[model samples]
Target: MAIIPFNKPYLTGKETAYICQAVESGKISGNGGFTKKCQAFFEKRYGFKKCLLTTSCTDALEMAAILCNIQPGDEVIVPSYTFVSSALAFIRQGAKIVFADSYFDNPNIDADKIEQLITSKTKVIVPVHYAGVACNMDKIMEIAGKYGLFVVEDAAQAIDSYYKERPLGSIGHFAAFSFHETKNVISGEGGMLVINDEQFINRAEIIWEKGTNRAEFFRGEVNKYGWVDTGSSFLPSEIVAAFLYAQLENLDEIQKKRKEIWNYYKCLISNTIENYQLPTIPYFATNNAHMFYLICPDLSFRTKLLQKFKDNEVLAVFHYLSLHKSSYYKDKHDGRELPNADKYSDCLVRLPLYYELSDKQVEYIVSLLNY
Candidate 1:
């Protein structure tokens, strides 16, 4: 049997053609024609106030941090179970990261428990929509409103997913998305920052253009552009944008196939898995089939299960480690036990998921789990 890798990047067949077109356009730098197309697509389709492409999701998050004007001693609430970029961005701004726990049933931040962690120093609440499933945004937003805190949605894995009919990235004052090869959409490495608040739109462009008024100069709104604020080279090259635009053109087709694979895996394993938990999609969230992961009962069991998959010539993998307990942040963490985050760090396993994964492959992977 052929080994099934954990993830395969999907190609929509127009990537090369688009790349050639971008080359022919004579400009491959950031914020070119292709970049604008990709940005406009998100803004028009999702009702986002503004969108800016970035070199990576990490860049987008960093831009958001700068826009928030995070200062030393400011507090930013982040889930302990998510990718490091989610917290690292705020930490870079000298904000004290207040790590929160995940829900018992889902690996998303527990919105109900967030208020207890809030303080006068709290400046932003970042809610990462894990596995494209929506967090309890309604409750999270309510808490932020009551406390006068900014909300930034870490929607890196949540394109095309929604909360109560509103798009995932649209709910927060700022949002970040990824188009890494492993994501449903493929750009090899890319991301976008969505500015939902009008106040941040103009400044976001300036920040995205490396702290200058270059964007305004290009638009004839300014005579000349110069260094005006704190920023970095966050935008991506036109080649990345072109590849992403091709993927966006076939978004519906890609989503339909991926969802079929997701449903098939769930149907195959849900009834048979006695000691493990499957992903849970809240009623308010629409599944974009970004990933399909399993939660084993404990570290030992998960380790054994991973060995089983490897023995059967199938590759499976675990997800993020608890950020609060990481080597860099363990001492800084307030020593609050994030049980749910720890549980997920040890137990969660992601199987193969992509547009190219076929029914036979899904069944074969499930067979290993059954044994």
Candidate 2:
């Protein structure tokens, strides 16, 4: 039996040609022509104030942390059911992470529970848009406004997703997006940091250029550039940008095909299976079809179901093991039992989803769900 992998990176066929063009043009470094084109695509399409390409989403989050100026003892509220980068970015800046619980019915942070978690030490609220579904941004933004807390959206899986007609990355004060191979869009490993607040725009450029003002000097806005801020080598090379631009050009077609695969999984699984909870898209959110996942009835059921997948030579997986309970953070946690976050940590199973998935493979995978 041929095994079905969890994810396969899709290529637009123009990636190599673009890379060749970038190399022939003689500037294949970060923030070059291809980078600008990629950045402009996001800015124009999503209405983001500014976009800076980074080597990875984790780097983007780190840049957001630098811009936030987090200090020791400062608290940043983050959902327990997200990637480590969401919390690690702030932790690296010496901010204590205050892990929040997810909604009982969904993987997104519980917006209603967030206000109660806020304290004088709270500096930011990091919302992770899990599986490309929008979090409750309206409520979240309202709470942030009331508390004067910054919101850095971890929109790693939320490319092209929207909340109430507003794009996900455009809602937060700062947002980070991923272009990992497994994502809807791919450059093998790439990401972007979005600056929505004008105050951080200048500082962001400096931070992006390794704490220097080189970008300004290049633009002739300054006579000379030197070390002026704090940053790291966060930008991806032009080769990655070139590959990403090719992917961006075909984003609509890619999204259309992925959404078709997502719908196929939903329709088949919903009809053939019972008791399992299908993915729920809130009325205010638009699905970007990043990955299709289902919540099994319980941890035991999920464990056994995964074994079944292995036995059948199909790849199935779980996501986010609740950072609050991890060994590194368990002792550091505030001892609050986040049942909902833990529930998702143990129960959510992502099925294979990619642009090139065929109807025959879909039927085979769906048939396995009958177990």
Candidate 1 per-residue lDDT over residues 171-200, each given as its tens digit? 999999999999988799999999999999
For each candidate, give its TM-score against the true structure: 0.99, 0.99
Tell me how candidate 1 scores on lDDT. 0.94
Residue pairs whose backbone atoms clash in candidate 2: none
Question: In candidate 2, residue 291 scores what lDDT?
Answer: 87
Q: Which stretches of candidate 2 lie over 4 Å from their true place?
A: none
Per-prediction backbone clash count: 0, 0
Superposition TM-score, candidate 2 onto the true structure: 0.99
Worst 10 residues of 2 by lDDT: 267-276
